[model samples]
Target chain A: MFKRLFDWLRQPLGLIAVGIVLLTVFSLAAYGIFLTQQSSAQPIQFPHRTHVGFGIQCLYCHPGAARGPSAGIPSQAKCWGCHQQIAKTQTSALLAPLKQAVESGTPIQWVPVAMVPDFVQFNHRAHVAAGQNCEDCHGDMTLVTIAENPQVFNMGWCLDCHRKAAGEDEAKLLKLADCGTCHY
Target chain B: MNSKIPEIKLSEEQTGKWGMVIDQDICTGCQACVAACAMENNLSFVGEVDAGYGRSMHWIRIERFWEGEYPEVKMTPGQPMMCQQCGSAPCEPVCPAFATVHSQAEQLNLQVYNRCVGTRYCANNCPYQVRSFNWRDYVRPEPLPNQLNPDVTVRRMGVMEKCTFCIQRIHKAEDKAKSEGRELTDGEFTTACAQACPANAITFGRIDQPESLVSQLIRKHGHGVKHLEELGTLPSVTYFKGG
Candidate 1:
């Protein structure tokens, strides 16, 4: 029985089966890694182009940009304010979630594309007031189908901009580079 | 070698040298400041066992001492002990990772938690014994964590933490002022302890501004002194001695 098993292992058909199994395992792993690296699934397919083309400003949906630390996601009511009239036909597959949210009074939980670590105290208000546009850090959202975090907001990335700005406004930029500025 | 160290110059932009003045007369020894500081900074509450082993974390603590003898024995008023934010901080040089450094911009002794590698050298080198090291990973059980101030980071195990004069409030106030194209007004912002104090004992402000409340208080009461002035830490926090 052992002699026969050894003879079978040496066969071309057996070797081909093992090769196929290994290839499938490696390919699956690579695909899994790619998926994780790319954007995760969002609740709704939010088209920035359509809204931007319609002359809607970024702050219109994210009002907190001008007033608060966060550029917060708009409430369901805010969405329904415009969507109720524009998306009159609720039967559309894309508008289905919006309609259901409005009816159920449950807000859409959008998967956040851009996320800074908990340690970082990012103030959207300050950045906006400093003559910085959303596109500077977030890339041109109008061109993307789905919003994605284009820039990795690491310390080095932030310091690069701060170091440049320090030349013009040393006082303000010095505060920006301070550890307590963001990490406090 | 030169007999004396070179004189340090304050930059033009370094207009404000932030400092605090705690009126010992008004401090009720309630430890409200301690509770407020811990909550505001997301400081871990080590269990009784850990606390027994001197693992408790308190950015600001009330240090009480007994004075006089038997019949005339009196307990001195609790003095709030915290990071002095020393101008010549000894902890700055001992930190191998450069985690603890003096911020010229804010006149603060800042502890960069991310850069910290659990070397307790700063704590050992500190004369005031203000810095606390995390010996274990403290969990912020259940609902307690919900109340944590989002502005401050929840420090992990193997990192040293100390008083930052409520740096988050400073940043927020500064950002607000900068955005509005103005300077931060005196009494516009304060440390959490100063804010929470019922007696209004703790006064925090720019010492550079003579008109500021802290500076004025220091001027009016010429008895203000650093905890251990003999050591020459040049501590930012000045204690106003009371009878």
Candidate 2:
């Protein structure tokens, strides 16, 4: 039966069918990749550029960056603190979700743009303490609305910075380069 | 285990960065170390059947041997067994994925779980039988998952895990010390097993530091034995024989 199908596939009609099948597979794979790359929809727009324009520091909203592993999303109360003082909170279209969430005492579900694999234990304090700017890995937040990863947070990317920071210091290099440092 | 292999000689002063001295005489075999290890490392609890079949995921185990005849049998003092964090580990060389390797800075064997392909070759090569493979994805229902230590990775099915000597605690202590711009003071922190031991049988610290508590204890009691030392594994943990 396979031999008969192969013989038929040698003809123009069968060749077109084969081409269609191949195209479908390729397109499906491409679509899957596209979906993975696309960021998940966030509950609130939370404009980084607008806040940054008013000279509000990144640490002002997400204070955990300097203190611990996770640079946690700001609570609704924290959001309400600033938004309550603003006259635009009363009627602005983009600020409606924040007003509703704050009134209902429901937290905003933030979709983290910059995320590493669960296996890779990324520490914000270590990176922040190393003299890395918030813009370094997280990109220039002042130019964008939502947070975007500056680069792919791969092992190679981490190693490159670590190696550079270590320079000629053999002990520092060993500690930084050790697999057990970030990964348990 | 090979008999003829020579142990790698580290510096005269430094045996390893981290080390433990466990006094078997003081241990009560209460399984406190086992419980502490499980809680600290987020180790899965394999069911009774799987555990009986030697699939138990406990990192630190208390070993008590039986002596004499059936009529007058005596249980030996409890001896706690864990990953020795071997200087020249047998498991390091056998990993096809390069998942298991020696940490030069920490002077310990490290198992990179992300890199591990569940080959089980490292576990097979281990002389002390410390490494345990995750046979299945053991679920932590509801609030049990909430109790997990965020520092340690909750291993999925097929990854090989073992006692890390609480590397997470080590890192946390070191990070704290670094932030404060001071060296990590001796006895500032310890492994969960050491901290939880009611009898104070387990002493853990920087063995290289001659002044550290673990080093002082090791020196005070120099007759301690390294399990399977003849294999040239150069285990970091030292156990004093109990009467």
Best by DockQ: 2
Compute the lDDT of residue B168 as modeled in candidate 2: 92
Q: lDDT of model 1 at residue A35?
A: 90
Show the colliding residue pairs in model 2. none
Put down candidate 1 lDDT per residue, A57-156, tens digits, no spaces: 9999998999879999988789888887874536678878888888999999888888888767888997888788999999998787678778988989
Sort candidate 2 into its docking category.
medium
lDDT of model 2 at position B78: 93
lDDT of 2 by residue, A31-89 (tens): 99999765568887777898999999989988999988889999989988888999989
lDDT of 1 by residue, B137-199 (tens): 888779887898888888888999999989889888988897788999999999999989999
Which runs in model 1 stand beyond 4 Å of their true positions? Answer: A1-33, A87-89, B1-16
Each model's lDDT: 0.86, 0.88
